[model samples]
Target: MSLGGESWRWLLASSSIPAIAVVLLRIGVPESPRWLLSQGRVDQARAVVERLRGNVEAFEDLVRNHVSARRVRYRELFGKKYWRNTAFGTIFYNAQVVPYFAIYTFLPLVLLKMGVGEEDTTSDGLLNLFLLAGSLGGLWLVAKMSRRGLTIWSFVFLIATMAPMAIWPDAPTALLFPLFLVFTFTMSAAVNLDQVYPPELFPTDLRSSGVGLLNGLSRVGSAIGTFLLPLALDGIGFSPTMLILTLVLVGGLVVSLLWAPETKNSTMD
Candidate 1:
């Protein structure tokens, strides 16, 4: 059944909310002092930190404790550690985005094929509702667990949820929607930690480059996955194809657990 007209309006309203947030960020956010230092403007960085901290003594302490702690130089992010973190972060971020796009593209198509007519957009409505709920839950998870913990648990949740979606395609809608909820919950929330986690793993000087490169590279993987999912869905069908999603989540879970160091209380100098 195709969604009734109200369903389209609901999706429009739902997506519009996030768009508003993005616009607010663009207008309201300020640049970081670390970026200034990373660009070789040490005086500008000192000025920014001094203004932020309200005392030169405290700022100097930060420079000594955090900024100058690294002897390899922040510029050495072009070296091995940066490359390793960037590569891992990029690959993992990409893995995270794949299932999201897969759902965006495949879910409606699947619903359409499964006998949802043009007049009913129940699947779309259900998806939008779950997405909102997942987002709210993710915010709570972040508030309660810290970003790193949520990042870890997001992958774990993804792995656990993928099992049901893979094995029980024939299940009733009530059960199936909850499985979608699990997957959507993690996928949506993972983006918050993606940028947060990588920079924490890198030194303060190289943080921006590390985060930028990783985020950029992950999108490449997402693009590839987006292109490939339809082909996989066409050839392998739902259950077998979705198992690939399960495996991807499993890989992400393993990779994240192994490589992502905890950064809950850490901060840049």
Candidate 2:
């Protein structure tokens, strides 16, 4: 049933379909209402809000209270007022993604080391389901929980789930696999906040630039982690590598406690 030697080329090329679809779909998307309001386009912003079924009165209030017409330069993100946000965004994103990409990129090797065979398709399917469930759960919890609480607690649970395997790398497959699944679920859930937090952290004028900067930096971290993961596993072995990643999660927890803001019910302003 396997394909020819050129299968990798087709598989890689297939990704462009989604990319092209996104480009086409984005053509019809409206500009950000908040950004419009920031630019003094109150009527256009209100129209966008109304079309989206958002709170028009709130949008009006936002418009009325809008004071700044000055656009934020990228350098301002490093200024005193936004410096903590920049630091938090960069650290928080890297903390979540570094281990995330590293582990998932080499998941097969990870599972094999934990005694799961490549033939264990059922476990793979179950793990994917758990990831999906976790993502949905995260979306639900984003409304019910404070953003700070969710970010902190998710990091706490991620550390808890990972510490065991790091501490006992040779634990029984039964125990280790379940821990891995918990880690997967927690990671998937927490990753959703990546989409939520950065924009909220910045004002409308700076939002796009701030998010763009964070995303760019986060990808650098991901790239480095993905590249170094296999080398770490080879040189330091799985146990130490897991320990290192657990430390990274701990770093995330500390950063969240110190800097993650509660934007759950707050206005975009």
Candidate 3:
């Protein structure tokens, strides 16, 4: 049954429950020990560490010997030493998220073009479940595979899956559905690396600022792509739109091969 009328209002309003829960839960969260140490609250930092783990001696020694009090400026991300990381992060993140948000935002339209109507909630729900499974699989892959390998392979698989839809937009729903399931799975799996890479790319000093800037830029890219997607779909139709999105994935693959660093099992410094 298609939901109509004020059902959207309830759906929209229900989002606030999670928002309120997050706010409440955040109240009990402890401050980051590194940030605390950076602020020179040695005792408080040690206390926080002690609360979390039994052995605080190693943490204490590392803080005393290695860390220094310093504030990182956002402009430093563009400097020669860090510029490559910043560039890679910005491009890779935008590349994935742009098509990701665009497709999910207009999924119903895309599905309709592929012979699956909007009212086929069974397919939609299945796609969502595949996304969740892919996410869990991605977390496991992080432990089993190197960061660079996982990133590069995920992009490769994403392109492979999406290429079919681009080439055969009028393929029967039977074929299209399976292709879409693979695309959604690979896309969500690759997205897990978004959380893995940025912090590793920068040192502790610049971690927060670098991640913040990359995340902000990604939002802008996603918003622009989301805004333009419907126009592209309406103007050029499904096959061409899928072709364009596939190109975006190709760009990500190229950049990942060139710039994605191997941070797995590497020092944060």
Candidate 4:
């Protein structure tokens, strides 16, 4: 599904619009001295800070502080504190992706099946509107919320929202669309927050590995979740059907709340 021939040309042309990226860097771009020292380039980092800050004294102090943060023992990832964090992260992180993608990606079709269509009141416009609201709502939530905090809040919304769709299958349209609206909104927040949480929790040594393993495992769960939806929910009722899935979220949240530490303000080194 990659770009082929003319598609490649078209894509490069589309991607070449980088004037703003250059402008933004000129306006303000702070280099990480930690990045320099990690690569064994201390002198280069010092030069960068001196040039950027215009005062060698203050800049050197800041670089020293950055270097202190960089002194992480990679072995700590295998320690007790980090071990369960990695395991729980891999399990639930993978678990959430399953149901989330199944529902969110095919939501329009799901809505149509539930009765939003060309002949329906909004004539498919409702789904488009829901997506727009969802995109904006996520942007707003992420700006002010911790990844874990946002994840917990989203789970509350999902339990409240999805339960009704399953419980009251014949629920009125008036009741349903709001659930749809909120479902899309919260799903965006949940998915993004889940993706952001893991790497920050790990030290630099295993950070990428931890996130990559979690993400790779979650992609498998997503495939299975999609497979189950058609085979199960489509045939059975959506209410009792999601009981197991709901429990999975509850389990993930419980683990995260009790054991998943806050990482929003923590520096990753």
Best-fitting candidate, measured by TM-score?
3
Pairs clashing within candidate 1: 1-115, 1-116, 1-117, 2-117, 2-118, 2-120, 2-121, 3-120, 3-121, 4-121
1-269: candidate 1 lDDT, tens digit per residue: 14785787787789989898899889834456566655556677787766676567765665555443344454565575566566567657876887777667667665543345545666667667777877776666665776556766888878787777678777776676666666776677666666466777676656666777777777777787788878887898877778898888788777767766666677653
Residue-wise C-alpha lDDT for candidate 4, range 1-269, written one tens digit per residue: 14455786776677556866778767756556556656667788777777676667865665566543354555555577787877778666855676687776565556754566635656356656766776677777776887777777777777777777776767877787778677766665566666568877776656766777777878888888777775666677565556656666777767767666677877666
Choose the strongest candidate by lDDT.
2
Q: Ten residues in a row with the worst lDDT in model 4?
A: 66-75
lDDT of each: 0.69, 0.89, 0.88, 0.68
Query: Which residue pairs does candidate 2 place in steric collision?
Result: none
Candidate 4 achieves a global lDDT of: 0.68
Rank order (by lDDT, best first)? 2, 3, 1, 4
Candidate 3 lDDT over residue span 38-146, tens digit each: 7788788888888888468788676768657777777889998999999999999998999999999888888898898767889999999999999998888888999
Clashing pairs in 3: none
- The backbone clash count of each candidate, in order, is 10, 0, 0, 1
Give each model a TM-score.
0.75, 0.93, 0.94, 0.71
Residue 199 of model 4: what lDDT? 78
For every candidate in turn, the CA RMSD to the true structure comes to 4.7, 1.9, 1.6, 6.0
Order the candidates by TM-score, highest first.
3, 2, 1, 4
Candidate 2 lDDT tens digits, 1-269: 15889998998999999999999999968988877777778888888899999998877777777796785578999999999999999999999999999999889889988889888898899789989999999888887888899999999999998998789988999999998899999899889999988889987778888999999999999999999999999999999999999999999899989998777767666
